[model samples]
Target: MTASMTGFAAHSLNLDHASVNIDLRSVNQRFLELHFRLGDEFRALEPQLRELINQRLARGKVECRIGLTMPPAATLDNGLNPDILERLAHWQADVLQRLPGSAPLSVNDILRWPGAVQTAALSQDALNEAALAGMRAALDELVESRQREGAKLKQHILDRLAAAEAQVAGLAPLLPALAAAQREKLTERLHEALGEAGHERLAQEIVLAAQKADIDEECSRLATHFAEVRRVLNQAGAVGKRLDFLMQELHREANTLGSKSVAVETSRASLELKVLIEQMREQVQNIE
Candidate 1:
């Protein structure tokens, strides 16, 4: 299916004592570019996260921002650590024996030590796992968003493609008539220049000039390119580069038709073809 390079997805993971929010955004770019705005605790997961993104996306400027929020100390499920309490007690006794009248450690101080509160603080492994899971879920949504946008882009391009095809087709039937008129004009000019003596040479020059004015080859190649674009859009995976190249080819043909214009009809058709090709090219820029 076609995929656009622009999308957004956000996911949140709630752990025992904390919550992680994952936000993934993508925009159009020539290649896969990744930017991370993870907290320090989640920095270790960057490499794995990068791999996951690369596995799923082929092109875009992707940004992943993960925010971590922790509950306040007042709200933690608190409990005492016996080992820490014993160490603090021993140190307090030593200090009292030496200083005789020194102020003792407060009850609040003992309770506030590291590991003092049995806040089910997340372990590294647990946090990492949850972040990864959240990332995966966000990616799923991101891909879906891109696909939906892509569908719209594809339809837009196809509509312009149809218009461009009509422009080319309309010019086809008029070509022979245009060629005949151009030949007669050329023959008249040559006769005026060289009279009866230049008949043979005039016939040769007319043949050469007619070949130059023939837009049949350009039209044929344009139709072929159009078909290829439709085919590419149907197949799976990245197609932006291919579509971009096809746009160049289409533009080239349109320019050729304009350069060789022998009548107002052909010139107008060339202009219309150019406008339609430009529209399709703009839409293709967002495809993947």
Candidate 2:
């Protein structure tokens, strides 16, 4: 299935004392480019996260922003460390014995001591695992979003392909008639210029000129290219580049058809073909 290179996804992981929010966004690009916004604690996982995105996506400029929100001390499951408090109490008593008039330790002073309070926290391994899981979920949703957009783009491209085919078909039946009329006009002009004695030479020149103006080959290649486009759209995975190349080929044929045109209808059909091809190319820029 086709996939667009633009999408957005967000996922949050709530741990014991903190929550991690992962936001992934992508826009069309010629290659896979990753930008990460992770704090020092999560920086180690950047390479792994980039690898995960590469495994799923083919092309885009992707930005991954990780937001970490730590709960307040009031929300934490914390309490004073008994061992540290006891040691501090003993030290304070010794200090009071040495200096008889020394001030007593206040509640704030005791709480301010190192290791005086313990708060619930996740281990490094646990945090890494949770963050990775959240990233995976966000990546999955991003891919799904890209796929939904891709489906719409594919339909639009196919519709344009159908229109182009119709234009090619419409021009096919008119080719012989157009060539005959153009040849008659050319022959008449040649007769006016070269006179009756030059009939044989004029016939030969008309045949050659008619061959040059024949849009049959261009029209045929266009139809073939259109069929290839439909086939590519049906096949699986990363067909954007291929489709882009096909658009060039289609445009080339349309240009050839227009350049060699003799009839107003053929020129208009060529113009129409070009318009449809341009529309498809624009959409193909976002496909993957």
Candidate 3:
């Protein structure tokens, strides 16, 4: 099924002693645009994450944020650097010997000392693998979210399509009557303007007026365009661009129908078609 460009998904995974959290958000855009917000440690993974997103999505302005958290006491040593502590202890002993009256280092002072504790770097291979797994989970959820929105968009577009089709259908039965009325009115005007000697001119003007008022061709083409819209909607995968183009075509037909309209009902139907097309255009902008 097709998907939408608007969606959001967040996922978190615990791996080893750290947690990897991913947030994905997307919105409609003419093209795929990706941005990442990752902690320094995971910054190098941006390229891989981008590649995965590009493979799955065709259009959107997408943002990805990665948060990594390490528990306070995940390791046995609690991230303490023993070598640095030993060096500090040696320095403190020398200072006490040299200055005799110096206060001993308190437990708070030891804990606050630089290098008293350090965070261990996780294995690169392991972090990468875990991050990739977490990303996959988030992406799967993102796709499902987009798909659900796409389904709603499809229904909305289909509804407008039906309304536009109904407008076109309503115009059909009105055409013959409108055309005859237009011919009679134009003929009367021509007779008044050119007198009885203008019979030839009146006939030509009537035929020309009838031809200008003809919208059957526009209506037929609109029907065909509607059918194509349905077909594209039902087909799988990124269809936003295609649907957008169809919207323009549909709008063109509606405009032409309005221009050729000879009756108030036909003109109103044409206006309604334009309204419906505009609504569909907005919805199709987000289809993927």
Residue 254, model 2: lDDT of: 95
TM-score: model 2 vs. ground truth: 0.83
List all candidate RMSDs to the true structure. 7.1, 8.1, 6.2
What is the clash count for each candidate, in the order shown? 0, 0, 1
Candidate 1 local lDDT, 63-118, one digit each (tens)? 99987666666334545666778888999999999999999988788765655544
lDDT (0-100) at residue 179 of candidate 3? 77
Cα-based RMSD of candidate 1: 7.1
> Candidate 2, residues 143-241: lDDT per residue as tens digits?
999999999999999999999999999987887788789888988888888786666888888888888998899988998999999999998889999
Ranking of all candidate structures by their TM-score, best first: 3, 1, 2
Clashing pairs in 1: none
Worst 10 residues of 3 by lDDT: 112-121
| Superior by lDDT: candidate 2 or candidate 3 | 2
Q: For residue 79, what is the lDDT in candidate 1?
A: 52
TM-score of 3: 0.84
Q: Model 2: clashing residue pairs?
A: none
| Evaluation by lDDT, superior candidate among 1 and 3 | 1
